[model samples]
Target: MSKKKGWVEQTDGYLNKTPTFQFILVTILFALWAIAASLNDILITQFKSVFQLSDFATAFVQSAFYGGYFLVAIPAALFIKKNSYKLAIIAGLTFFSLGCFLFFPASRLATYSVFLIAIFVIAIGLSFLETSADTYSSLLGPRRLATVRLNISQTFNAIGGIIGILLGKYLVFTDHNLQEEMARLSDAEAIKFGQQVLQRTLTPYIYVLIVLIVMIILFSVTKFPSGKVRKKSGEIDSAKFGETMNYLLHNKRYWRGVLAQFFYMGVQTGVWSFTMRLALDMFPHFNEKYVANFMLYSYICFFVGRFLASYLLSRFRETIVLTVYAVIGTVMLIGTTFIPNMIAIYLAVGVSLLLGPGWPTIYARTLETVDDKRHTETAGAIIVMAIVGGAVLPVIQGLISDATTMQFSFIATAVEFAWVAWYFISEIKYDIRSTVTNKSHSLED
Candidate 1:
C-alpha cells in the first residue's frame, strides 16, 4: 500500500488492529476516575460531620483535589511522552492505590490535614489516568469516530459516578443521624465519635485500593499497540513542547473548545453540588435520603444520556447534536431557576440528561483541531486541567446561593450551558464557510 492510502485506511477503521481487550481496559479507566471524583463529593459532607469542619475548611478538600489536577496535568502528559501510555497508567494506578492506602493512616490519625494530603495524592493519580486514558481511547478508534468513541467511554464514567454515590450512601454513610447525634455529645465524647466515624470512612477507599491492584496486575501483563503518532515526515515521535504550545496557542478552534469544556465542567459540578439542597428546599417534607435519591436519579439520567448521545453522534453531525443538547440544557436550567414546586427539581435532573455529551464531545472536537497528531497527548492534558473549573464554579454557585437563593444560583449554570451552545453554533458557521470555500475551489478547478 502507498503511504498515504495506508494512513487513510488506518485512520478510517474504528479499531484498526487495536485489541478489543485493551480498548475495553482503557474505557474502564474512565469509570475509575469518575468514582474518585464523586467520592470526593461524598467526602465533603462526610468530613463536615466527622471533623466538625466549618464550610471553609471542608472547601479545602476540593481545593486540594482540583489543585492536584492543575499541577499534575502537564507532568502527566510529559510522563506519557517519556514512557508509554501503559506505563503511565500503571504509575497512575500505583499512585491511586497508595493514596487509598494512606486513608488508613489518615483515619487512624483523625487529622483533616492528613486526609487532605491523601486526597491530593489521589487527585494526582486521577490527573495521570485522565490524561493518558482519554487520549489512548481516542487513538484506539477511527479518527472520524473519535467523538462517538469518547462519548461511549464516558458513559462508563457516568456509571462510575453512580457507583461512587452508592458506595457513599451504603458504606460511608451508615448513620444518617450521626450529625444530630454529635450535637448531643460532650466534647470528649464527640471527639471519640468523630474518630470512629473517620475510621468508617476508610472502608470505601480500601475497596477502591483492592480494585486498583487488580487493574494494575491486568495492565502489567497486557501487550498494547504502540499508538505512536505519524507525522507528515513519517516520524513516530511527537512534536517538541515549544512547537506544540505555539501551535495550540494559534489554534482558535482548540482554545474555544477548551473554554467550552471549562464552562461545561463548571455547569456539571455546580449542578451536582446543589442538587440535593435544591431538592430539600423545594420539598421540605422530604428527608435527606429521600432528596438524595434525586441526585442518584440525576446521575442515572446522565449515564443514560451519554449512551443516547453516542448513538446520536454516530447518526448526525456532532456539532449539531452538541448545540441542540446544550441549548436544551440551558433552557432546562432556566426553568429550574424560575419554575416552582417539584417540577423545578425535575428540570434540574433533566438538565443532566442534556449535558451528557458535553465533556466528551468538547474533548473530541478540540483534539480534532490539533493539526499534528503528536500533540494529542499534551492537548488532552490541557483539557483535563480545565477540570479545575469544577473546583472553582461550585464555589461560585455556593456564593450565589448565599447571596440570592439556591434557585437563583442555577442562572449561572444556565449561562454556562448557553456558552457551550454558542460555541457549537459558531463552529457550525465555520463548517459552512469552509464547505463553501472548498466547493468554490473545486468549481474553479
Candidate 2:
C-alpha cells in the first residue's frame, strides 16, 4: 500500500492488517464518551430521585461534563505535546474507567455530590480522549477522508446513544407506581427505593468501566500505525502560558472563530438534550417515552446529512454548502417555531439534517482563516469552546421552560444557531470578496 501525505497518514500496518480492529477500538472509546453525554438526560430524573437533587442540581451533570472540556482542553494539548498519543489515550481511558467505577460508590451512598465528582472524572478522561483521538484520527492517512474518519467515530457515538437510551429507560424508572411513590413517599421508603433505582444505573456503568479498563490495557500492548505528532512543535517554545495565549489573542480571526464555536456548540447541545422533552411536553397527545424513542431515528438524519456534506464538499466549493446549511438551519428554526403540529416537531428535527453538515464544514472553513502555527491547539480550542454550548444552552432551555411553555424553549435554543448563521454569512462575504478581488486583479494583470 502506498503512504499518503500531509496531515493524513495511511501506513499499511493500520490499513491492511488492522483497519477493522482499529476503527472498532477507537469507535468504542468514543462511544463511551457519547453514552455519558446522551444518557445523562435519559437518566436525569433517576439522578434526581436517587439523590434528591433539584433540576438545578441535576443540571450539574451537564455543567461538570462540559466544564471539564474547558478545564482539560489546554492541559490535554500540553499532555499530547508531552506524551505520545498512546500514553494520552491510555490516560484518558484510565480516567474514564475510574470515573465509571466511582459511580458504584456514589450509587451505594446515593450522594448527588459524589455523582458530580464521578461524572467530572469521566469528563476529565473524555477531554483527553477527544483532544488526542480527534487529532490522531485526523492524521491516520486520509485528510480528505476526515469527514469519514469523524463520521465513523460518531456513528459509534450514535450507537452509544441508542444503547444509553435503551439502558436508561429500562433501569431508571420503577415497575411500580413511581408517580404515586414520588408523591407520597416517606424518607425511609424513598431512600430504600432510591437505592434500588440507583442500582439500575450503577450496574451498567460498572460493566462499562471494566470494559474500558480492558480496552485501555489491550490498546497499550497493541501496535498500529503510529500517528503521533511531535509535541507542541514551534508553538509552545515560550515558558509562560500567558505568552502562548497572547500569541493566539493577536490572531484576530482565530479568536473570532473560537467564540463563534462556543455559541454554536451551546445551541447544538441544547437542541439535542431537549429534543425528546420538546416533543413529549409540548405535544399533548404523544407519549414522552415514545417520542423520545422515536427521536433516536433523528440520528439517521444527522448521519446522512454529514455524509452528504462530506461528499458534496468533495466536489463543490465549501462556501456554497456553508451558506446553504446556515441559511436553511435558520429557516428551519423559524419554521419550527411557527409549526405547531407534532408532525412539525419531527420536521423540526430534520433541521438536524442541515445541522450535521455544520461541524466538518465549519472546521474546514475556520482553517481558511488560521495559520498552521498553532493548528492543533487552535482547532481543539474551537471544539472546546463549542462544548460551552453543551453547558449553557440546557440551562437556558430549563429556565425558559420554567417561565413559558416548553415548546417555545426551542426559540431560545434556536438563537444559539443565530451565531452559526453569522459564521456562514461571514464565509459568504469573505469568499465573494476574495473572488471579486481575484477577478479584478486578473483584469489588471
Candidate 3:
C-alpha cells in the first residue's frame, strides 16, 4: 500500500513541477499551426478548380508551403537559441498574422502564385511555432513523460484541424457546383465568379489573422518562465551553437529518426492533400462541402486516436506502439490504393487513426537521445525541417496522379509508411541486442 502511495506521490510531483499556465499557452501554439496546416486540404481542392490546374500544378501549393519550413527552420532555431521561447513564439505569431493578412491581397488579385506566396509565409510562421512549441512542451515535464505530454498537446492540434476544415467547408468551398456552371458562362462571367469565390476564401483567413493578433497581445502581457537551463552564472549558454550542431550531426539515432520523420510527414501530407480529390473521384455526385465534412470526420477520428494512443503509451513502450501503428498505416494505405468505391474513402480516413501518433512519437523518441539542453533548439529545428517531406512527396504524388490515376498515386504514401515501419523494427532489434550485449558484459565483469 505504501509503495503504491509513493508512486502516486511521485506522479503528482512530476505534474506539479510543470508550469500549468505556460504549458497551456504553448499548447495553444500547437493548435494554431494545426489550423493553418489542415486548411491546405481546402486550398488544394479549391485552387485546383479556381485556377484550372492539373494535379501536378496544384501540388505546388504544398511545395511552396512546406518549402518555407525547410528554409526557415534552422534560422528559427538560431533565433530561439539566441533569445527565449517566449520571444520566439511572439515572432512566430507576428509572422502568422502577417501571412494571414496577405491572403486578402492574394484573393483580390486572384493569382495562384500570390496565394502560394501567402501559404509560404504562413508556413514560415508555423515552422517557428512548431520548433519552439514542440521542444517547449517536452521541456516542461519529466523526460519519461515527454511522449505523453506531446501527444496530449497534439490532441489540441487535431481539434484545431477539425475547426479549420469546418470553416473551409462552410466559407471557402461553394455548394453551387461552380465547375459545371462556369462551363455555360461567357469568359467575363466566369472571371467574375472566380473572383467572388476567391474573395469568399479570404474571409476565414481574416478571422485567423484577428485571432493571431489577440494571441500575440495576450502572450506579450503574460509573464512566462525563462524556459532555459541556467549555467553556473545563471545565464543561458549561447556559445555552444556550433558544438551542438556537430553533436546532432554525429548522433546516429537522431539522423535515423530524422529520416523516419521525413517519410512520416510525406505520407501524412500526401494523404490529406489528396483526400478531397479522392472523395470527388470516388463519389462524383458529392459536393465539396460534403467531402469537407468527411475531412472533419477524419480529423475527429485523428483527435480521438491521439488520446487513445497517449493512453496506450502510458502502458506500453512507445517504439512498440509506434511500430504497430506504422504497420497498420502501411496496410491501410495499401488498402486505399487497391480498394474500390467508398471502401477506399473509409480506408483513407482509417489511415489517420494509425498516423495520429507517428509525429509526436518519432519526435519524442529522437529528442530523448540528445544529451544537451542548449541544443534543444537546433535539434528541434532539424526535426521540423523533415517537414520538407510534406513538400516533396505530395508533388511526387501529384505527378503520379497526373500521369496515371489518383488512386494509383497513393502508392507513394504506402511506400513511405512501409519505410517507417521498417525503421521502428530496426530500432527495436537494435535495442534488444544492445540490452543483451550489456548484460553479458556486466556478467563477465
**lDDT winner among the candidates?**
3
Of 2 and 3, the candidate ahead on TM-score is 3
List ranges where model 3 is wrong by over 4 Å: 1-16, 430-445
- Order of candidate numbers by TM-score, starting with the best: 3, 1, 2
Q: What local distance difference test score does each model get?
A: 0.80, 0.65, 0.83
Report the poorest 10 consecutive residues by lDDT, candidate 2.
5-14
Candidates sorted by lDDT, best first: 3, 1, 2
Task: Count steric clashes of candidate 3.
Answer: 0
Q: Write the per-residue lDDT of candidate 2 for residues 281-353, one digit (tens) a residue.
A: 5654554355555446666676677678767777876768766776777667666666777665775678767
Kindly list the per-residue Cα lDDT of model 1 for residues 284-392, writing each as its tens digit: 5554455556777888999888878878877877789989999999999999999887889999988888878888878877877887777878998999898887777
Strongest candidate by TM-score: 3
Against the hidden true structure, what lDDT does model 2 obtain?
Answer: 0.65
Please write out the lDDT profile of model 3 over residues 221-312, one tens digit for every residue: 88665556555554455437788878887899899999999999999899999988898877777878788877888898888888788788
**Estimated TM-score for each candidate:** 0.89, 0.82, 0.92
